[model samples]
Target: MTTPYPRVELGDLPEIDVFSEEFRAAPWEVTSRIHSPNGLARSSRGIEGLTYQSAHTVLGDRRPRIGFDEMYQATGFDESSPVYQAAVTSINNLEGDVHKVLRETLGRYFTRDFVQTLRPVVRSIAEEILDGFVPGEPVDIATRLVGKIPSRLFASLVGAPLGDAEFLEKTSDALLTVFYMDNANHEVVEKAYAGLAAYVEDLIRVRQSSPGDDVVSYLLDVERSGRITRHDVIVNVTALLRASTDTTAGQMGLVIAELAERPDVWERCHSEPGIIPAAVMEAVRWRTGAWSILRVVREDMNILGTPVPAGTDFFGLAVAAHRDPEAYPDPHTFRLDRRRPKPTLNWGMGVHYCLGKPIAQVEMEEVVRLLTERWTGVHLAKPLVTDGEPVNSRPLTALIGHTPR
Candidate 1:
């Protein structure tokens, strides 16, 4: 028998709603029409004989025959076409090289041992941000606190000069906007792409002339060894900036919003600092920085009784899955003390899982722990919503005006 197509309404999908007090207290009360297990099956069925559209496929579809029109028709964005083969090839070639170089070059700095050393540094940054807080006035926390810290940290990690922080943040935001926002202004995407490429090219040259103890220097060294090329360095650096900047910053903003809305949960974290990690994990599950990961079926097969054809596009909806009541009891509630043991698909699953999971966890844990310990009575001055464009589902975007005790 032919596969029965899953009929579902997109509007019925559970979105990340931080503004609803009811949602904050009990988010899982809202059922997700599509979730991990069932959503995967639904996506598999939808792509049968149809082209897959989305940002993730932009690089994976290696052939030119997979043109922009087809890509736009399937995915919504014309830029999703793998038009930048040179860039894509360079990135693929350098993935192994960069992973190794990161291990050798900055491994000492980011290791669990060294990360422990940075706790003081992380806390200092947190304090510095809080120091600038004006209790009664509205402030965009994303700009004032969350966005700035990660951008600075990422720049320092890459050995980019302090002056470049603003530029880096702008470029990262522009790039994220290109993918995340609906009707992403084409001009912004092109301008951002060009600006970032120029910046990376310039940085690569500087690092080549004067090597340092940073990832850029490592890339320069590898380029000199002929194992990787200049093209490889630039592309990988772009990917690094995109990955490092947006995801963490976005999640940080979401966590702040969560804490602000649920003072009880924030108090729980304050009383028990050790729960910061679990709180971060739950926040990620609740907001899920990256909404979905796209993968192509290698062969025709059945998943959740849905017949997926070969080359079909399947998406793992992490945000939906994380909210699944079957997995997380009272999935929507911000209950720090909940005894239910639930696995989050926020970082993804299987081999394609995020490589930066450890780093992200560490950064989040430190931020939450320090924020809770240092401040009280934090609340939002504006509505919290998803940034960029709304894709499979909107992810939490920004949080503004955090009051200090």
Candidate 2:
């Protein structure tokens, strides 16, 4: 069942470590070094869809059964690994009817209506965090502002006390390393998976007795109806906690950090609140913390004329793809109001498209709105520092000051 197309092993393509410092700092430059006419990247991690079309295809293609479980295993994670064991049955790893069932079951809670209901909540949280900052004073915006909102929001959404935000933030980063194969084996990852699981179990128990209009309470109701298992409620809720925290935190932090560096953009976004939604899109495309979407195929498949053997890790490298000149003009410059053929790939695409996207979007949009309201402009107090990995590009430090309103 194979042709003679010389199965292109991405590892052999020379000088591209999609997870390396170079790739982190300059994904487009690193990807461009691999001159594959077929649009395949040489990154050892796997085949990359560096262009917008190929990235969309690689991420959105369901014919060959694209999934993360296979890719995680390809990275050598087995049942022996705690994180693997916990997530293997979660919706992130499920596919077909099983995936559809769980996805649809969870989808009810994330409806546009539900997300809008949370906006006032998002605004309330944002304002409280902003209130802590003194005028004309530099603050650790990364930790105090950008990092606080989403994790706090996760707690509120699940009906967990706001005090748990600290735990969620800690484990959320440890849990986030799952996306990066190099960082997945860190000692904290196992503890994160285990700890979050325990915390969620307690959360489910509380919601069982005091059910309310929250995600956990809703899942508990579904559990009683025999639509989903208790374990499903526990694992997926933990998964949602893991899902909602760090990525949104990272993106928010990046936007703040990047905007600090670009006062022109900041000034405009501040002056015209209506442009924040577009600014969010432009900023996400500019330096998305979400670098790639990890996917694997069960059978050998051809991607953009590049032959990929069965069970190989196929990455839709959003870090590079979003910057593809063909996809967006002047791709490097962070300008809003630019029209594009497709929506941003940062949230991913197709059936496995992020279930929490609406929540994340509302959180991010509301954040930009909040910041613009409080400050006429923002400028960095210090240089931004990050892990620099294409996936989960976390800002380690982002000190900044907001101009008085």
Candidate 2 ranges beyond 4 A from true positions: 1-15, 19-22, 63-77, 80-82, 182-186
Error of 1 at 189 (Å): 2.2
lDDT of 2: 0.77
Q: TM-scores, in order shown?
A: 0.73, 0.91
Query: Candidate 2 residues 52-84, lDDT tens each?
Result: 877887778885554545534544577677567
When summed lDDT is taken over every stretch of 10 residues in candidate 1, the lowest stretch is 48-57
Whole-model lDDT, model 1: 0.57
Per-residue CA lDDT of model 1 for 97-216, tens digit only, reads 554553344343456765565566656666777788876566667667787776777787688876687888888877655443345454565667678888877887788788897778
lDDT of 1 at 183: 52
